[model samples]
Target chain A: MRNILILLSFMFILLSCSKEEKEDLPKDPIILPPYNPTYVDLNDRLPSYLPRMDIPADNKTTIEGIELGRALFYEPLLSGDGTQSCGSCHNQSYGFTDNGKKFSTGIDQVEGNRNSMQIINAGLRTSFFWDGRAATLEDQAFGPVTNPIEMHEKWPRAVAKINDISTYREMGYKAFGVVQLDSVLISKAIAQFERSIISGNSKYDRWKKGEYQMTPQEDYGRKLFNKDRDEIRDSLGNVIQVIPGADCFHCHGDLSDFTDNLFHNNGMDEIFTDPGREKVTGNAYDRGKFKVPTLRNIEHTAPYMHDGRFKTLDEVIDHYSDGLVHSATIDPLMKNVDIGGVRLSLSEKAALKAFLLTLSDPDFLDNPDYSEPPPL
Target chain B: MNMNTVSKITAILMLVTSLALTSCSKEEEMGCWPPLDVPGDSANVIMIFNATTNGQPLELLKNFKDPLGRTMQVELLKFYVSNVFVSFNGASTLLKKAALVILVDPNVTDTTKKHNEIALKIPYGNYDRITFSVGLDVVQNAGDPTKYPSAHPLSINQNTYWDAWGKYKFFMIEGKGDWDGDGTLTNIYGYHTGFDECYRSISFEKMLTLDATNSNETLNVNFEVNDVFFGKDTLDMKLHPSWHGDINTIETAFIISDNFQEGLRLN
Candidate 1:
């Protein structure tokens, strides 16, 4: 009887202590090993001429985060039907674009209107999309996944799906120090991976670095590309000698990214088919204007322009040569719009094409790091 | 006293002494200009640069008749302001430590946009005159913009630099005009001025007061677009459609620069 009483007293004291400890426990316990991420230095990856990337403080690049993001980017589990991923549209082999396709087919087998933009040096751009709607890479990544026409998956559903997987939960913990995966963390990881996609090595880049020599034709083409429109006029204001100039340096300046990163009509339309930037700013002056893309991998990113109207590079050059259609919002920099276009001769056209091909970065397309990762 | 109690009292006294010493040092450092005291010697001033046409705030892309009565619409008008100096009692002081370039973009319809506003904090006094350069200094003009931060005004991403010419465009004015007044702006004209020779320094003579009584004050300066096109020298848009900082348009760019310098007035 004495032993039983002693045991009961001990059990009662233990239960009381357990209750007190449970009440003392913190509502949200502090995660151990704190939230320290290994930051990446882009100077080693990017060329010297390219400007420093403006990375967000909140979403600094980390090796762990990039690894998680690369896996997520290739995982078809992000899509509603589990048949598509970001890599489905942005294939590394095709310069991060749909190979030869004008528009990427979504998970619903529906074709998107705008072309899948090549992701080369995308971290340097101020805006995303053809219309410049999304302001940052994070904001851009938040799109597509929930876009009904693209991934066709709701944010809640996507988060639930990701959380269901143990590998992703582990990745989430490693990347963000959080076990509960959400859209914000996912977008940040994807943005870090996208920022890691730096492409500067090209034939032209090699030539600029004195590692490769340009052919005579390519050199002549480069000169024409930089030359200002000079019409040796007679006393009667008529052309006497044609000092042929393609004059492409203004909008597509050759300083760094080969893009001015500004919106332009480019005299491609006479009517409003898709009011590109006007939809965003709601200004009449912005009507028919579209964001100028980088010409880094112009050779691989076929079916060019916002709508991918031109099927070939020759067709694109031809459109700029004589097929300019004027609108009210035509960029004043399009100096040759009144004369149809720049009016490039056959030899000039071929040479310009050759020069554009030099912009193709073979190493970028074959970069194993950018390729889809194996199963997690 | 017991050792434990004595140790606790000693620790408390040490903490108090350290805090007292820290406060004493801070108070001594702040004796000349106390932290609690309101800074009556300095005042904040806002310099507003506005783009106007004939005393009216210019709305971008809106059709307006120039002094020549040519129907024109300005698509873009951006310029850089640097080397600001203020003179008080025959003594001049440079406002900025370095060549701080402020790109004034007057493209917004909203007149209160901060793009064209320059805020300064200076000594509270009556200033006789204010002088400022309308373009970048020689060193800043030649400096590689890629070295600057992305958000910096002199960043390469601003798309104002002329890489081929190896100089920045100090003044960029792009527009279209209907010379015949047929309601169609068919003619395009871009008069971009750059290079060291075209930089203009303008002076405003006025009794500008930045007294303690008026800490937050605003000074409005207007850039007359009509005067720029037809003020000093008439720019024939038909003859010279564009002046893109090339060797062929250097003379015309200089004339345009002079016209721009002549277009400023107290609004």
Candidate 2:
């Protein structure tokens, strides 16, 4: 009986010691499972001629990170209420833009002030947003989640929700090799996913590579789109000859990017309402300027312009044709403004739309890689 | 590893970090580190730009009569101070130079901060002269603020640099003037000074001795409000009510910028 008591005491000590060690395993760096990060490689995928993306050193593209980001992106759990996600506004079917909606509805069903833009080829771009307020994609992700009218969720609560889930911990470890869930790591992962959403495989790209052919009207529109000169003029502002091309290339030029990536006061209105770039840059001269968006996937993305005032491409073409309002801060690129606009005829407007359609890549929109993953 | 081992490792790491920080602090005790240095002990000076009415800090929103008996109330005063070249000796050689541009808003005063404080850390010695440029020199002022990081001093958010005008506003001030002197401040008077022609570098030759024992000083760099309008060329509020970044305000811009140099006093 005495020997039996000593044996039982020895067994109890072993059991208690093992339990204590198990509780403290996470604290012990040596005992924890080695965090093997899934590295993402995209060297061969991107075109050679295009300049390399300026990815932040801290947030390198990782396969696990991008996958986790895409999962977080589609998961409505990130919203204030588990009802809306980034994919809700930026639907993949519409080239990662709003689904023909003028303004996207938030969690509270409140409409946004500006048009939701597609972040295709965003990694190559320097500044983020229409006003270029957010400097980086990582910085830009912080906006919609906390904006009072948008997601309406505080970052602390959003991070806490993701931390509560066991799957996120596993995914976080795979991406960052660190189990700690923070807003910075979350932002970086989302930025990586955004940067990976490249839209360079359009019909126009294939046409440039001599892989496809454009329709007659589409070809005419392409010519007008790249039109830099509107007839040669003398020292005086007189039209020596009536140039019949749409002078749209100056502000929206550079073939591959399809945008100058600069802000312009494109004679939208005579008076300022939503002081676009002027809010970021306090200069009075920049009162009406806004960042020029890329023309890629223009057909899929509708309700054009920053405010989404024009519903269709025809209305947009009409604005540049004759509806341009003269402003004191008008860009010098609006050279034909003396005659009101480019004055594209009825047939010319239709042709411009045809050419814009060639920029849409159906393959990109239907890519399963871009689609939301199956339930975790 | 167990809890005991983890605690031991943390304590060792803390000790190492404490020692490393102490070594760095010892080196920072000297005013100038790495390249620029002088024999004497280094000292720091906290400079303030104040709007004054008869040698006293001028209060905004309070109507005061100027020398011309014009009732005025200074609503806003903002300017940039950069290219701080301090000369210890009477010679052309500069004692120390700080290559930084800082915005100074007199309305918000906390002398320790970047916006309010214009610190000068120079070698402790008696000097015949001290000089600095009031505005960004030609090269420093060049570059689109949009290209720079958002948090930088000369970023577009400050409203100092105008891309359309292609220049930085060296000094800006606004006030309400009662031109008729009926004691009612109705009319607004603004002097938005800038352009390449207005950028001025002023030099003050005064006998200033640095106390080696007490290696710190606070200097009052007063920008007399009246001097900006009345010196050399008086502002014609009737002719130009608001002088913005246009060709119309070039004359007033020159007058106000010229007075900025003449209005200085290192107290």
lDDT for each residue of candidate 1 in A190-283, tens digit (9 for 90 to 100): 8889989978899988987999999988988887777656565565767776567787887887365788888888988899889998888887
lDDT of 2 by residue, B1-267 (tens): 999999999999999999988865322333221223445577776665666775667765556777788887775577766655556544543433322223323223235545545656667667776677766767656745443332344544444654334566677676566777766554555566766677788677766667777677776677677887777677666444545444533676777888777887777
What class would a CAPRI assessor give candidate 1's docking?
Answer: acceptable
Q: Pick the candidate with the highest TM-score.
A: 1
True contacts kept of each: 0.40, 0.00
Interface RMSD of each: 2.0, 13.3
Q: Each predicted complex: what DockQ?
A: 0.32, 0.02
Candidate 1 residue-wise lDDT, B23-109, digit = tens = 554323332111122234776666777877766678777778877677888888888777667798778765642232223332233
Runs in model 1 lying further than 4 Å from the true structure? A1-36, A232-243, B1-40, B88-90, B97-113, B214-216
- How many clashes in each structure? 0, 0
Indicate the residue-level lDDT of A334 in model 2: 65
